[model samples]
Target chain A: MNLLTDLIFDYTLRNIALGAAVLGIVSGMLGSFAVLRRQGLLGDTLAHAALPGICIAYLLTGSKSPLVLFLGAAISGWVATLVLLRIVRETRIKEDSALGVVLSVFFGVGIMLLTFILKHNDANQAGLDKFLFGQAATVTAEDVNTMTILGVFALLVVAVLYKEFKIMTFDPNFAASLGFNDRWLGVILTSLIVVAVVIGLRTVGVVLMSAMLVGPAVAARQWTNRLEAMVLLAGFFGALSGVAGALISVSEANLPTGPMVILSLTVIVIISLLFAPQRGILWDIKRFSKA
Target chain B: MEIVITGILISVACALLGTFLILRKMAMMSDAISHAILPGLVAGYFFAKGPDLFAGFLGALVAALVTVTLVEALKNTQRVGGESAIGIVFPAMFALGTFLVARFFENVHLDTDAVLFGNIEFVAFDRLFIGDVDFGPQSYYVAGALCLINLLFITVFYKELKLATFDAGLAATLGFSPFFIHYALMALVSVTSVGAFTSVGAVLVVALMIVPAAAAYLLTDKLPMMIGLAAGIGALSAVLGYGLALAIDSSVAGAIVSVAGAFFFAAMLFSPSHGLIAKARRIERQRVQIGLEALLVHLLNHEGEEGEAHESEMLHLSSELRWLPQFAQQIVGVAANRGLVMQLHGHLILTDNGRRQGQQLMVH
Candidate 1:
């Protein structure tokens, strides 16, 4: 009862909870496309690649405002995607190797820049490290609003291009043959995912942010074969974990919210993997035993 | 100097194993193991009541093995795709590690940021003393031992590793257990990760293991050459990275990885066998050759026809073959320069050589 009242009445708690929920919903919704397209690790790479952008944004604008940092993260992440695509297309390096290269190299540059900024300029660089592991407690009402706006914009695009995205996700060649500009559609989809990574950066940080993208979507997959249900269910699962993680982390001192949220998502994944009616492993075992 | 040596040693160890990992297409698995070992290191610390090295190493190795096993299990279930399985497991393990650190060791040296990028700057100060005798930095010995182990492992298992990597079915049929080779290689990767954990941190460990090997891969095809080149590249990155970090006053591991990335970029663009520039040139040459051949075939077919004069006129060439005006002009210029066709009075007349070449092309 006290916790519920605190969540409702407490300003910081309310902001953190709202911000986390928004991140969860956005990543969950877009991550479904990433997973279905088998680009599940792209989110991880994007999140890592966003660190350099955040540092550069600070260096360029000298502002800690979420909007500026979000823009910086989105732009750099988009560039990383372009680099990743070029490597795969132009070189013998496979997609997996390219992903590793981009993820690590971009992150290395980000770290180099971050350390340089720390050594040269001490002022206003305090909260910059928060993006590495994410501190939900620092989330403010304004940050929440920014996340909400971006999340909605991304989701709205997804909603508007729902059928096109579905076709592109499953059969991109077919989508292209149908004159859907599948390449552009793919770029749009990756851009939306970059948005999700940017929004989630403040709440889940970069390291564990991919889980927010992969877990809920994977969980949602076990329950349904349809894209629509999987996306909706993923959003719901993501929101639940986000709020739950926020509450649990806030209840205790020294508990990091990002990991807590990931832990919650992991639980959801295990449950979905074990108990979903048609696809559950237990059901398979039971059927096998009966036979 | 100690830090540079430590960096080179660790980079070599990782690159040696990384060559195989990249060949196996398990590059991201190294990334996974690197992150997943965090919880194990923390758990080892928790049980040991301090940051004991052996405890952490054991804990991390166990954690890495568990991560590999779990990913394989998940993949085997057919419920999750391999990439998705990897993407799911590592974060969960890392999150648990972060939770442990936040909960119990918040005030200790087990910082989250340090785990990501590492604190290699202080590695020089963290000397190994044996009975009052100073033995330089501890990381040097750790890295050196890992290098020796990886070198020996690769040497002993070269044939089996090669067969298993290139053709697992063949290895299996030959009574060699692919599963054993896979797990053994994974275990060494885990050990190397633990060894490099403190000096380069987790992600850079991946950067070291993958980036150098990937660059080497672009530059070579022979497995032995690839491994040597990977080690050489790894060492070069370490030296360059050390210099870069000293100049910029930043993270050494980050500098090293950035340097490694530069090397990969260079190999991608300039490698003679498989580089982008070389490939582009080859493709351009092929395109021009095809265009010239098509022009020959087109002209030969129109030769002696009722509309030969009209069809063979340079003015009508673009409309006749649907070629763009610029392309038609360039082809005509090349053909004229090569003495295959003559442009007299705006008419394209085939030369004796052109007739012979067109006849030859027609046969093919």
Candidate 2:
């Protein structure tokens, strides 16, 4: 009861919880498409690739605002995607190898730039490093507003283009034959994913942001065969973990919210994989024994 | 100087293993193992009551194997995709490590920044000693031994590794367990990553491994050549990256990886056999050659026909053969350059050589 009242009354707690839920809902929705297209690791690469953009944003603007950082992250992540595609198309390097290259090399550049900023700049650069392993406790109401606006915008775009995205995800050639301009659709989908990744960076950081994108979607997959259901369930799972992680971290003295959220999502995945009907491993074993 | 040598040795070790890794399409596995080993290092430190190296290696090895096993198990369940399993497991393990680091080791020597992107700047001061006898920088010895071990491993299992990598079914039929080779290679990768962890950090370890190996892959087809070239590229990148870091006053490991990336993009654009520029040039030359042949064949067919006048007109090349005006003009210029065609009053006339070449092309 006290915790419930605290959740309602506490200013910092309310902002953290609201911010986390928005992150969860948005990432979960975009992650469904990523997982279905077998690009689960794409989120990981994009998150790592966003580091340099964040640093550059700070360097160029001298602002730590979420909106500026998100724009910077989105632009660089989009560039990385284009480079990734060009490598795969023009060279003999495979997609997996290209992904690794972009992820690591871009991150290295980001770190180098970060160190350079630290050496040349003043103490104002202190908060910039927080993106490495984010400080969820530091997310203010203004940050929450930025996250909400971005999340809502991404969700709206996905909703408006749901049909095109569906066809493109399942049978891209068929979508092309249907005169859907599937290439542009793919670009838009990835763009939406980049937005989701940028918004989550403040809460989860780069190292663990991939989990927020991947975990709920994978868990949602075990429960349903329909894409619509999977997406909704993923959002539910994401929000559940987010709120749970926020509450638990608040209760604990030293626990960080990001890892706790990831840990919560991990438990959800374990449960879904073992117990969901029709696709569950436990169900499979039981059916085999009966047979 | 010692830092450069340490960087070279470590990069070489990573690149040597990385050649096989890229070939096996397990490049990202190196990334996963690098991050997953953090919790193990934290545990190792906790258990040993200090920063003991052997305990850390053992714990990290166990952690790496566990990660591999979990990924495999998830994949075996037939639910999670292989890359998805990797994407899921590593971050969970990394997050757990971060959680542990934040909770327990906040004031300890195991700082998160040092663990993620190593402080190679201060590595010259951390010397290795044995019974009051100074050996030198500890990372140098670690990197040197790792390079030797990886070299020996590759040498001893060269045949087995090759067969398993290219054709697993044949390797199994020939009595080599592809599974054993896979695990053995992974074990070695884990050990090498732990060795490189203190020097280059976790993320740059992936850069050193994948970038140089991938660049070498683009430049060659032969396996032995690829391995040698990967090592060479890694060493060169280390030297250049160190020089860059010195100039910029930035992270040494980051500079090294960035240099490695520059080498990769260079090779991608310029390698003779497989480079984009070379390939594009080849395609362009082929297009012109095809245009030349088509022009020859078109002119030869109408050599003595009643409609030869209209068909052999220079303007008719585009109208009849569907070639663009510029392309048709370019083809005519090339044919005239080779003395195969002549422009007589704006009409394209096939010379005797052109007729002969057309006859030859017809035979083929």
Q: How would the docking of model 1 be graded?
A: high
Worst 10 contiguous positions by lDDT, candidate 2 chain B: B106-115
Cα lDDT tens digits for candidate 1, B183-220: 99999999999889788898889999999999999999
Q: Can you tell me which runs of candidate 2 are displaced by over 4 Å? A: none
lDDT of 1 by residue, A1-291 (tens): 999999999999999889889998999999999999888899999999998999999999999888998999999999999999999888989889999999999999999999899999968689887766688889889889999999999999999999999999899888989999977888889999999999888998988988999999999999999999999999999999999999999999989888999999999999999999999999999999999
Of the true interface contacts, each candidate retains a share of: 0.86, 0.78
* lDDT, residue A177, candidate 1: 91
lDDT of 2: 0.89
- For each prediction, how big is the interface RMSD? 0.8, 0.9
Residue B229, candidate 1: C-alpha displacement in angstroms: 2.0
Show model 1 residue runs off by greater than 4 Å: B301-309
Error of 2 at B195 (Å): 1.2
Each model's lDDT = 0.92, 0.89
Candidate 2, DockQ score (0 to 1):
0.82
